[model samples]
Target chain A: MQPAVSHGDRPRLPIQAILRQTQDLPVLPGAIMRVIQLTGNSDATSRAIADAIGMDQAVTAKVLRLANSSFYGLPRKVTSLQEAVILLGFRTVRLIAMVAGTFTWMTRPLKGYDLPPRQLMRHSMGLALGAQMIARIGQFDPEEAFVAGLLADIGKIAIDNCIDGKISLMMQLGIKGGMTFEDVERTVLGHTHSEIGAHMAENWNLPQEIVEGIRWHHNPLGSGNSWLAHAIHLADVLAMVTGYGLGGDGLQYQLCEESLEICRVSAEDFDGLVEQFVGAVLHGEALLEGMG
Target chain B: MDVRQWNLSFGSQSGGGLSSHQFSVGLAEIRVVNGPTLLECQGIGSCIAVIAYDAHACVSGVAHIILPKRLPSSSSDRPGTFMDTAVEYLLNELVKAGAVAERLKWAYAGGSDFVHLASGASLPALELGRRNSEAAKSELSRLGAEVVGNDTGGTTGRDVSFCTADGDVKVRTVHEGEKTICNLQ
Candidate 1:
């Protein structure tokens, strides 16, 4: 798609070209990738996944820390990756590994978005926890929702890397012109971060549902109202509401109202949901501290 | 300057260089203070920051309210989590801190609907911001507190700072930067 030349002087690159620069994109760490692959294999055993995660010492340390953190409320300390996998299940271990693998990358400052160190990570954690809770309520796969929520904004990092200094200018212009951030992104870059993020997810061979969740989080209706997309949408809003990471965008995205219907969350229970989400965020924060 | 730094500089300047101590009120949290203390709630989106102050008593309180009402199943002891409970909690804390109940002035910021739904979308759940703001005003009215200012109902998030000594409320948004919305005094 050709982006409108609103800023004629500024260079515009098509989303395809941007994605073609594979080196600029974040590489899913090898250990995490192996775990993800194993997660999809019905024959994969807990010991196999644990051995794969143990290959990365840093990731293993983080996983152990999180497993021992109060977020899990384990009765005893978890000292080994194998024990963690057996106790927390392969799915939860995979989730923890994903968080550990992406922690440093997500914590980097995104000057284009005006997000400082740890701010974006905090927001991702909040969204991950919120999406997990909402997924449980909706009877969806909570683990998948958590991963989608965690990686939803990764496109912003990719955009920041590709555009460098141009994105901040676009953000300012968007705010000044009273346009939504996504609209400004589309106008200037031919794609919003959601689209770029979806492309990246696809490149990383993430599940189709997660790719769609990241792609249409801002406008789930565009995804034919997929439940995962809607859950991520609501979780994104919930993350903002709880004041997780209001960067330059700061609630600039639109909420898809049908998300509630798709997520099977009733209006009467919304307050309770907020309360539950807040509690989950607090728990997630504890896990973050453990990662430190 | 960035909003956070700008808020700090503004606080110190406006409080006559009293070495203001800033306390952040997080989600579903409330903070009450006296002297040159500043209570702040940042990244407020679809959440309300309900501010109450008594100029005569020099006491101020800010609550980061998440919802309109408390749920029956919610066992959270944090009063600031809900609009109705937040008002009652803030008022009680203010009075306990030497602020006169009748002399209290109220103001609020935030409760923005960041989601833009289709025109006919029927999700009432997305209206948490509006409901929070309405419930705040209604609860404050029920308690006979005079609301002096309101900066709410938009599609953007806000960062709100309240000065206990001067009763000045400064609201910052990505679009508007930072500006004092009201002074209860």
Candidate 2:
């Protein structure tokens, strides 16, 4: 499907201008950014990581609340950042901070895509859990997969923001014409959200693995061929299948077959993984609601 | 508390109480409810929702069916998990809950693949949405059920609700506004 020029003479905005909007988008807080950095450093002590979170009062509050929340059911209250970090483990605390930092834009309703409030947040949570589950089964780094899954679709925000109000119309046209969302995105905007999201990640100075996961998530074979990307790809499909939070495109995105191999799972294993993913999403929902 | 008792005991005299109560039908689950209960299911992307109603008895049921058939190794005992068993399970439960099988009417929505490969072809596993729709039609016929309304196949998700009080099944799509796709009465 050569980018359908069928609409003829529709004024299209340049991709460069669209990419520029992502600069205004908020990146992860310094505290959480440091936590992410420390997680990858084997020699980083827990106290150093705790000190990083303690620097941000807001992150500290959220981490304590999550550690004390029913999801953890801690016997005693976590009064300080160090206690919260120790109680929840450095990796878990880091994830909490990331989720907190990203929650704002993710929960907002993107009118261009006709997505309801919290739809993308829910989808991201679902994908995060799905990626973690696959990581657990495949013996990979679950934390890396979790972060990758959570941010894989962050580019959609840029696309929706740049597209203005044409989301619903383009969505309708895609559905009516039987075009994949990527195809529709390319047809109307020249570049897909993956590229836009990758640009956003670059602007934020995110880790290379995270950037590749977001960029190649929809098409792992096309780019860096990162296993993390494959995990996010499979997770996204499973998220769509379970209908965790459907946006304008719904289940209209193609499922990448190589993901199964990337995750080292067969089709039957994929089915079991889906059931596990659903359970994790349900559990994650309670914590997310508590965060609200 | 049972859904019926919980609704009736707290129900408003103005007929507003029971309608406020909603029961969610999750993946591969089914529930039979009597009026004025509302049964809701969400995000039926590649899955299907089979809604059956007996208007006269105010007995309605919904099945959120996930797959076309239950694989032999599937450990789930829930009958509503597959198309082959969903309608029969729903019908049996409705009858046991006071609906007459002969009086039952069916309506369904969901079974869409909004995602497809760039080559305009679906991977074999990804084609389940169309296959699910086909299995649903065949299963409905096999059970001799009358299907009165249908909204299936597209590149979108549907949020579905079946009101037992009036047997009204409403479907809301992402781009399309909500509509009462079928009524069993």
Candidate 3:
């Protein structure tokens, strides 16, 4: 099962050139960007967050719909942006806005990777929910974990946009050549999606931790054993194992054994963790439905 | 067997006199069907799909197995949830469908150790795919069923489609398109 052409013999692009191509990719929506900024600010008020979200009618409608959706299981209807903010809280609302804002692009099919419409979004939501659950268990900030998981594969979008339709060909060659997906990406594209995603996060002004999480999700040890990176890695694997929105890469990514040790999760907990992770994804299906 | 535990959710049903139905066997689920019916396990990673088919009776059963073994404290009643329990339940259902135990042909797929810490990583916890494949083979042998075909122990996820009509099993992967792995007949 050797590749028709040797990987080393294939022409490769420079990382800078690849990044330059991604420059045409859309930036984060203004309202979503503002919400993210305010969410990170210590002195920011719920009113400020609500106003930031309200600035975008589409995002505001989505946030309110999600707040009232069965995903949160609110006792009563959420009538307005302010009311929804008060009920779902700032972080949750911010998450909803971010999800809604990214919904359009995230749901687009990536022919290069063979991802159909909404599949990537489903995977991202699953990863976010799984990461949030693991964060709760590990006593880390669940919100940060959720954000990191949601945007972890964003590099794929950029790469897919940059590489035209050659990604699938590269994937085939790599798999046939017994190379990992990331390895193939690095071989031909000059950098893996993780690295590209990290760069995108940096440009988006995401926190350094989240940037690192995206960078080292495939190799958490590369981040000096960061817990967030490990959590994201585990979440990504769990999403794939549960068969939520799998792409051409499928489950080819590596799961670090030391991630369990770093996150204080044990082998015995695998079944329960999977159950909870699936349950969370199921419960959050309404949120995805609202986006659709 | 609890009737409630028998999950027979159909994915698609074709219209016509001879209706062809497709049943999706999700995580920890087992489904048995007769001719003109297809049972599928999609996007399987780490989890194993243990299939038993009796070509004579045109009956097939699939168990979407997740774990190598069941825990004592585990409250799950789905036999297909664990490799240890899945084989027995799947075999019993096949027998009930008029499949002879000795005549049944077994095929399994989708135990992938794609995600590993490093090359030759030796953590038992991370070897779920290998453990699942081993468990499936051992359990099928214990039941005296003839093991026919398998596509397991790789870093790629697989989608397995089994046609009860002919006992043909097709496996599809991301890199490789769908191909028939075996035909019990």
The best candidate by lDDT is: 1
- Tens digits of per-residue lDDT for model 2, A131-248: 9888887788998899889988887887877666676677787777766676677778877778778877877788998898888887877655588988888888888876777766
Worst 10 contiguous positions by lDDT, candidate 1 chain A: A1-10
Measured over all alpha carbons after superposition, the RMSD of each candidate to the real structure, in angstroms, is 4.9, 5.5, 6.2
Q: Distance from true position, residue A67, model 2, in Å? A: 3.3
Give all candidates' CA lDDT scores. Answer: 0.78, 0.75, 0.77
Give the distance in Å from residue B31's predicted Cα in candidate 1 to where it truly belongs. 1.6
Compute the lDDT of residue A122 as modeled in candidate 1: 82
Inter-residue clash pairs, candidate 2: A251-B114, A251-B115, A252-B114, A252-B115, A253-B115
lDDT tens digits by residue: candidate 1, B1-185: 12234344331213222234667778888888875567787678888898888877778888888889888898788887888788898888888899998998899988887654545455676677888888878888898888889899876667788865556788976556689899887
Give lDDT tens digits, candidate 2, residues B135-175. Answer: 99999999899999988887788878776556678888756
Q: Which candidate's TM-score is highest?
A: 1
Compose the digit string of candidate 1's lDDT tens values, residues A1-292.
Answer: 1122233234367777877753546777789989998987889998899889989898898889888888788999999888998899989998899899898788776666656567789888887888898899999999999999999999988787555557446656765675667777776777788988998898888889899999988778878778888898888877866667776675345565578787888755767777888888876777877454
**DockQ (Cα-based) for each candidate:** 0.32, 0.31, 0.24
**Evaluated on chain B only, what are the TM-scores of all the candidate structures, in order?**
0.86, 0.84, 0.84
Worst 10 residues of 3 chain A by lDDT: A1-10
Off by over 4 Å in 2: A1-16, A19-24, A68-79, A268-270, B1-19, B22-26, B29-32, B72-81, B84-98, B115-123, B138-144, B164-166
- Of the true interface contacts, each candidate retains a share of 0.48, 0.43, 0.37
